[model samples]
Target: MIRKTSLIAVGVVAALGISLWGGSAMAQGDSYTIKFGNVISAGDTQNQGYALFADLVKERSDGRIKVQVYPDSQLGGEREMIEATQFGDIEMTAPSVGVLANFDKSLEVFDFPFIFEDAETAYKVLDSELGDEMLAGLQNSGLIALGWGENGFRNLAMVKGTVKTPDEMKGIKLRTMQVPMHIAYWRSIGAAPTPMPFPEVFTSLQQGVVDGVENPYELLYSAKFTEPAHYLTETRHIYDPEVILISKDFFEGLSAEDQKIIQGAADEMVAKIRSLKATISDEIRAKIVAAGGTVTDLTDAERQQWIDSAIPFYKENASKVDTEKLKAILEAAGNTTYLEAIQ
Candidate 1:
């Protein structure tokens, strides 16, 4: 009778152990670590926003999901990180729409110069049904688009002097991203566009390898390009909006609750980024002048001329990518002149 009781007791304990182990294993399976990579520098508005996203995800998930952020190209350049995200090598990345245009040619519409006259107009198009369709289209490319983040506007920072008009841009060896449209636009305006990596920009400016570089004021000042290329123009030529992306495969594998947590956190992150960017350009513009850099604003006529200069580019490249999407964006932005011209 003792032996029988001992065997029954052992069976009860074994069953309890099995139940406890199964519960623990299920909990472990629910937890996930997400790796997010970007080229934005640490402590920049974008990274600060990303940090908030990580915190929110962790809090919302009750510590079941953790986001590990790698900024300043710690993972790699924007293009490299994007490919990594697509392949599930990294879970997330935010890349400028220009670089990402290479992946989804439909995005090339945003890369066109002088497309958005102001941030408000850009936001209207981006938050519209049109934008949702574009974001949804990324699933075909193995990416889950979270939302649009700001890169502000692109302005010319020249070593020689302020370039207030397209005529002034003539023959200037300007540093450009290796993006074909940007290069083509610069060339059409008579500037010799020198395509090179971001790391080499400062040295190129200092050594006279390139006469100037173009980026937003924040990037120009933060990279110290303003020190070398002191002439800053408010070209506002390109309203760069970065897209936050996640790996489609990895995202699909997550629990539906976890997916909701990520999407909620990402929406908040994008809002934070846009809010920070609203005043960042003015703040950075002041800083550039304080450090003895020249900031030039285009007059009414000059701004008009700049807009007209892009007419030729629009005529040449409109049909090359997504013409319908391009037409839609131009029409939505109240650029009827460009819309008519392209048609």
Candidate 2:
């Protein structure tokens, strides 16, 4: 009788233990939603990569995590969205390194004009230990950076005439992002740099609020900035890289498994964006010309002239920011001339 009672007690305890374990598992299966905002248009390659990230996260999480993307400055411009992300009002944002440098001064290295000659060289610096350190440093600012995303090289799009040589940039009222380094560089070349928000760029161009704007070909074409700014120049002055950022509080609160899912998805998303960007500049250049826009290619001499224009700006400002980080990027990019000049 005693033996039978002990067996019965053990069976009841085992059944209750299983029931409690099942309940705990159910409790762990909570769902989360992410709001991702950017200035990229809906069908652009950046948005395409963002959409892929959303899909990958949801599928991998078995629909436990959902990401809603707001593009075309729907959630406001890059600065506003970055603020939103920091405050945890929004979950994510991808802002250009120039704009982001406003929050973290270490990122100002990329703001220097012509630091990178091509995307491959830029990628070499960005994917290195130095880049990871920079991204990791964002945690102190209440944000977590996933990885670097591309904005490609910035070129000139003018309202009337094409600017090939530095001399031609004189007195040209140009629109630039609210980045001090950019404004300083353009001003050094004698251009009047007007800092404005991205949303106002089109109307600013149309109403002559600004004489011209600079960006990658895809952005100029997709945003229809080329409609008013008909003269396109392959200045390729700045290699812009955007950071994939999430709210530190929001990210830290997620389960470890969920965090892994998000990080993996972001990695893939960046890769997709880069792959799409490889031939996009050329493809969009053709589209712009077909749409009755004038595209200009600088001669080798003209290009050398443009490269040389940044030297004075570098000599003046190199010691102002993180000189070692700047040196690392310049050295990695094979811009030995710039590295030596800054020294």
TM-score per candidate, chains pooled: 0.90, 0.92
Q: Model 1, 33-77: lDDT tens per residue? A: 899998777878999999999999999989989999998788988
| Model 2: per-residue Cα lDDT over 101-128, one tens digit each | 9999999988999888789988888898
Off by over 4 Å in 2: 1-27
RMSD, every candidate, angstroms: 10.6, 9.9
**Reference-based lDDT, residue 325, model 2:** 92
Q: What Cα-based lDDT does every candidate model obtain?
A: 0.84, 0.87
Candidate 2: pairs in clash:
none
lDDT of 2 at 331: 85
Q: Against the true structure, candidate 2 has what lDDT? A: 0.87
TM-score, cand. 2: 0.92
